[model samples]
Target: MNTQSLTKKWSKTICLAFLYSLSIFSNCYSKGNRIQSSDLKDSLISLLKKSGNDTLMIDSVYAHIRINRRRLGEEYKNTLLEYIDYTTKIQYSRGAMRMYDRLGLNERYDERYDSAVYYHLKSLELALELKDSFQMAYNYNNIGQAYRLQDINNLAIKNFHKALELQEANGNDKGASFTQNTLGAVYVVQKEYDQAMHYFRESQKIAVRRKDQRTQSYNLGAIGEVFLLRDQPDSAIVYFNTAKDIKQQMGDKKGLAVSKHLVGQAYFKKGNYVEAQKFLNEALVIHQKYNNERYIALCFDYLGKVKLKQNQFSEAGAYLLKAKEIASNIHSYENLISINNSLKEYYQEMDKWPMAMLAIQQNQQINDSLFSLKKTREMQALEIEYETEKQEQQIKLLSAENEIKEQRLKIGIAIITLLVLTIAFGIFIQKEKQKRFVLERDKVKQQLLRSQMNPHFLFNALGSIQSYMYQNDVKTAARYMGNFASLTRSILNNSAVEQVSLEEEISTLTNYLELEKMRLQSNFQYSIKVPEEMDIEFITVPPMLIQPFVENAIKHGIKNYTSGGKVELTFEETSDLIHVIIEDNGEGIDTTRGKMVSSHKSMATSIFKQRMKIIRDKFPNVPEPVIADLSDVNRKGTRIDLYLPILELTSTSNA
Candidate 1:
């Protein structure tokens, strides 16, 4: 049972609206019971009508609904729906987005999970329209939580990852922390304790760093839950008490209630009947007051177990029936499972063999259904992994064939050049020239291989996939496999070429950066930009020229970043040269390479310099790359401007 509430954050605008609503709706807010739903609705409509298309005023009224959501209860949802309609009519996108999100969360609380997902998607669409990455991530997280509550593991994981990706890329540490906990909760449902703990600890670290007390409490409680699940009641009690203390200090009534319920469960597990009853009763009162059916059901179920342990058969039956009724009404399968088990035990105690058998069958059916769901998830994971491995093998075979063909072509060219030179010049002259040509070709080949597909990169990339699989993150492994394979294919395809179209080069670089992002766990953001008017398809540059610089930016520049790492590649052109500017908002060259000198540190750069020397021999006018530390006064990063001859392929050349 997920006792912890999903964390939510509002914009500064919402805080302002909260203040604004105090003056406008003070009576309705302070004396909620005295105000009827129809009166509240009319008052809200009057406020909206007065506000017209004024988004700020409309948002304030929306904020009022959110602030009084619990007090208004069912009426609050009516207010949100009306708010959404008003905002939609006026094309107030921001207000509409928030309304939909609030409505979705309300639906989730009411256990209308599919409706929750639908509203969150609606919110996401508006978030996208407004180009608000934070809001988009928020909606994605909300959708994931809804799915997770319904035990839809696959969709839940997909949405949670999407939220995490956006949050990390945007350096939204708070959002990332919240998403991490949600992901942990999913693994907990699946009984993947190790993975669950991994995520919970990650979230804890972020909460600690941010000094976020609420999040810290949530993490502590979650850790307690794991201990409870492992049958370590004493350890669970310690954590739950800590969480309860924190929430009490914060005066968080709702959070404190959940913490009390967890503590009660731990006490029951420890056979402390009096303390368990005291805490569970307290939790049940608060849950009833708040109309939180899920936690109420949980409280009742656990209370029944405690009473059953105390040999109060009649009382146990009463509590279990209450739990069953609520669990059934809310469609809480996990809670129903517990209630059914409790009912079975109670029936057996009463010597009702027929009733006991019915409860046993019901319990078994629920367990079987949950087991089948888990099995389906496992089978899907295996299928994805199998397909990924199959693709990897195919790519390897293709790469091997390409290598053999390349070697044979190189031999044929060498032979042809030897014959032509021997006929044109003296044998001695041919031998000297051939020796120099062979040495240069070998040097270029070695440098190209280092820059194109470094062994370390291949090893690390494959290792990342292996780690994901071992962690049972099959989706991530499959995604990594696809990117790795595409990057490998691009490297092999481009290796034989002297030059490639800028479009093709950019595509390869995108795959490389995407893989790096996944491998590094989205600690950084990257962008590739070209002028809208520029014709990249017709423009060619030396293969692997820009990649080394981009690699350096990632490996040495931003490798150690927790967040806010940025790499940008922009393409521009003059009459003679195409300029590829690679920039990173990371440690400058001096701090990165000079302070931490290593052989691998500048290997790509050194190889790229040598490669550039070779390219300059063919295009004599090409300029050497310019390296600059972007650390004048305000910012610190490395910028490298690589100049290349604008090589364009003619129609005949293409043929």
Candidate 2:
């Protein structure tokens, strides 16, 4: 049967679950039990009245809601909100945390990532204040999952690792398994299949040991996704079917629907159109019953593709349009992109060139919007990171201040013991204070230099945006603006930290180059190359360290070049240092002149030299940066080699 027919026939699963719960309550009430109520809210109110101010009873209610939160969904949101207020009135921290966490999960189910993260963070704060490590870990996992859903993989992975560490430390194997599974899912989105498989297998091992059927089913489905991505439909189907059977037996209707969808995808890949359509329709029916527009849209899209493969153009068009309508209604750009691509194919097959063009245009616009959305999410992630780092710094500062106060108090007491001893202690304290003052001055100086560099970077980027805007090129201007936001996000994010992964540094450089490329109207081309064997994520480097040199290379070496200007960046690592080479095939620096051509170049060079001097003095063993003039070598380019210390990031540092 088709998806539409199946959807029409399927009854509401949530209603059924509610009815089942009601039946249990009815049965208990008929036996003259105290648990007599017309609905869950009534029973909750009765329980509250009986419990009075008992914290344990309130906690139990919170626990009950958590256990059945999936079944409850938004059905008990108002009840939970009311309970949260009551918990707050009674100062029940644990109950409030659990309630907020459940509300976060419900928001997550509805794809309200911002609300989900907000609630999860609220729960995390309570967990921290209460010193509840398990709750902290659970909330971290939830927050990570919310970020993961929005494709903010970096922040998601960071939160997942945080949760994993706490879970493993607390010996909460089930929580650890869940976190590991989520980590695998994020890796799956990132297309790191081998890494994904590793986590999945590890999670599966724990789930199996604990006899966690739900987690086992999740693992199976995740493993199937890896196989599907690898184009091993035959293998994928086996795993998907196994997961589906488990979910069915476990009465996880939502999970079963997801598995059926995966099964349909495997069948589609295996060229079994009939089987694919059947499974997709079945999944679509469940999705419709649950009112899951995202999955319903996905089911329709896949069904449309299946029909397209079978030469059923009319059926394909119908399914694809239905998918598009639902996707558009929900503003699911990613799904709309897929649906449009399929519709483009359908239009082409039917020889409707204009319709095909329209579909392509729609996809392009959707892709642009997706890019903007991605940048917005990245900005949100960066803001969260910055806030977290700021809080940590403030905590450290407070601790240091407290320690200093305690030291002074001890010194005062020690002074009463002996005058001579006091003199010696006074001298020692003076030296320590002087040392701290010097350290603080250096830190402030470094921060000043960084602050200077950021404004310079921002001004250059703003100039590029302004240039496009002047030309009445709205499309290019918008694209450039999006890239600018992305670059600004990276800068603001890295500005909070002293060091960042080489991968991040490279990404920032790429964003800068993209903006420059657009601004220069493709007058210059650039390439950044790193060795394939390099583990960029494991290697930490100074944040925004290379951008100034690249900026110099672009503005001085290539800006006025007539044609074929190119800038190349290459990375090489020795045992002790990372060698970053920036080479530009343009006019080399003219040393014969009395001074540099631009004040910006002079300041950039001076600031870079000072930063390098600071690094050298701090780490005496590190090599200094080198600049070579290609003009002297009879080449029309400048080459700079930056020898940075190879700092390895520990697992803890990633958090």
The most accurate candidate by lDDT is 1
Candidate 2 clashes between residue pairs 3 or more apart in a chain or in different chains: none
TM-score of 2: 0.48
Model 2 accuracy (lDDT, Cα): 0.72
lDDT of 2 by residue, 1-655 (tens): 8755543333232234334434543444354333322355655555555557876446545544443343344457777787778888878888888888878877887888888888888777777666667677777788888877778898899888888887776666756787788889889878899999999999999888866676789899999989999999999999999999988865678989999999999999999989999999999999999999999999999999998998999999999999999999999888998899999999999999999999999999988987898899888878977876675454332222333455567778887777876576887677576334221000000111234335656676667656655555545655565555434323322333456557656766776677677667778877788987565745667665677788888888887876688999999866446789999997676555443234355565676667777777655656666667797888879888787865534331111
Candidate 1 regions with alpha-carbon error over 4 angstroms: 1-126, 267-333, 346-351, 364-655
Best by TM-score: 2
Candidate 2, position 430, lDDT: 74
The lDDT values for all models are: 0.73, 0.72
Candidate 1 lDDT at 459 equals: 89
Per-residue C-alpha lDDT of model 1 across residues 92-170, encoded as one tens digit per residue: 9998898898788888878997788778878877776666676777787887777676656767777788778777766
lDDT of 1 at 301: 96
At residue 162, candidate 2 shows an lDDT of: 82
Q: Clash totals for all models, in order?
A: 0, 0
Of candidate 2, the 10-residue stretch with the lowest lDDT total is: 439-448
